[model samples]
Target: MQLVVKPVPDTASNQCLTESCAWHGFDTNPPFEDIVELHYTGYHEKKKFASSREDLGEPLRTEIGTGKVIKGWDEGIVSMFEGEIARLVIRDDFAYGAYGYPPMIPGGATLTYEIELLRIEKPTSNHKLKPSH
Candidate 1:
């Protein structure tokens, strides 16, 4: 399936260079290596449902650092910082495609997620919550 690329606003207006993404330059400034803990509020849109029983409104509370989820969460979460809010426009390639969610995400479907980075935590050898880098 062909993935439709939704142009980010800054990039679409030619306001920034490709090497430096305008989206990356937002208020969010978490370190690249820091593990991002976030609370995202968004919805998934597809032609059909991923699950026959589950509704589409089921919000996803993902702990991104553990690599326990989809590729979009893995990549998108790292690009945000504590308290940063982003409107993520995801393509089918980044989400469950072709054979969707066993039955919510459908094949060749696109999804959008409005994400908010609520917290950032640093891993420390000591038993203290290390300051965000």
Candidate 2:
């Protein structure tokens, strides 16, 4: 039997990982314990991989600078302002990397997220906010 091999494309060095996000304004600066509501659609190889239905699903709510999500997402969201829309381009190291995310994200895949920041809110007591050491 013969073995087959496939090459993984790096998407042109993955566009500098998380990219340099532009700060919208300082009037509404992001706090360490700030919570955010946002909508996003993820894509790899220019095909949609993840997202919720616009009519049925609620926006994702999470704390900023937390590792709850991927590294790229956390960093990208930190630079955004309320009601701002932007795209985040992330490389494998910041994304799923060599192992990838099962059947969805392939190995060495570069992920892109079209995101909209709904709101930046003060952390409610219910949220577990821990200072990053």
For candidate 2, write residues 5-85 as lDDT tens digits.
212224443444554233232345456558877788889989988884453287777777667677677666666667756
List model 1 lDDT by residue over 59-128, tens digit each: 3333453545555555666655456556555556666666656444557655655555656656556433
Q: Could you estimate the TM-score for every candidate?
A: 0.52, 0.72
Question: Pairing residues by index, what is the TM-score of model 1?
Answer: 0.52
lDDT of 2 at 17: 52
Clashes of each: 5, 0
Q: Any runs in candidate 1 off by more than 4 Å, and if so which?
A: 1-34, 46-66, 124-133
Instruction: Judging by TM-score against the true structure, name the best candidate.
Output: 2
Q: Assess each prediction's global lDDT (C-alpha) against the native.
A: 0.46, 0.66
lDDT score of residue 128 within candidate 2:
70
